[model samples]
Target: MKLQDILTPDCTICAVPAASKKRILEFLSSLAAEKLVNHDTFQLLESLVKRERMGSTGIGNGIAIPHGRLINATKPIAVLITTEQAINFDAIDHRPVDIFIALFVPEEECQNHLCTLQSIATIFRDKQFCKQVRQCKSNHELFQLIQQAS
Candidate 1:
């Protein structure tokens, strides 16, 4: 499925002002509530955090793909954000992460999750695209950027 299919306007966060991993994760976790992902926002946050602890998903170039699977859902939802200030995320490249795309999918549809991750990686591989994303000044701009992408 395409990302725009699930990226509602409220799910987008542009110019986020968080400065640390905990804050970033917490900020992302809170999106679950905003988007009505599930009843217990805490549970979703804990699940995502647990997955993160298994290993850092930050691959470098100021990008990170944090994702989690839930047993209560049947579809995937995504939240993309451009932080106002870069934050160290223990990325493999040891650089600060400024672009974050966190995803949530049902546990029964694991392959779709992989495809979503692949699509995000493939699109972000273009340095110019990443540059444009980092340059976005507002959520409308960020949403437009994503809409322009595959």
Candidate 2:
């Protein structure tokens, strides 16, 4: 699927000041909650936290794709956040992470969730795309960059 298919303009954040992984997930959970119905923000955060406890989603090169499956979710949801400064995320490369793309998917849609994660990883793996995303000055620009990259 497409990034735009799951990401909404309202969920795109630029220059966020989240200093820790917990705070980042909290912010993303709240953002994803806007598009969900009958889902608690704490529950969403718990799902993401649980996944992170299993392993860090930080895929190196200043990017982190944190995702979790939710039983209450009817469809996939994405939230993109670009922090004002890089934060330590226990990344495999031991590099700070400044770009985050979070996904919340239905528990039953494992294949689709994996595909979406792969697509996002592929997009961010492009050095040019990462550079463009880093240069984005606003949420609109960041969202547009994702569109262009896709």
**lDDT for each of the candidates?**
0.84, 0.90
- Which pairs of residues collide in model 1? none
Models 1 onward score TM values of 0.94, 0.97
Model 1 weakest lDDT span, ten residues long: 32-41
Task: Give the number of colliding residue pairs in candidate 1.
Answer: 0
How far is each candidate from the true structure, as Cα RMSD in Å? 1.2, 0.8
Instruction: Evaluate model 1: give its TM-score.
Output: 0.94
**Residue range 9-127, candidate 2, lDDT tens digits:** 89998999977999999999999987889688898899899999999999999999999999967899999999999999999999999999999999999999988999999888899
Q: For model 2, where is the 10-residue window of minimal lDDT?
A: 141-150
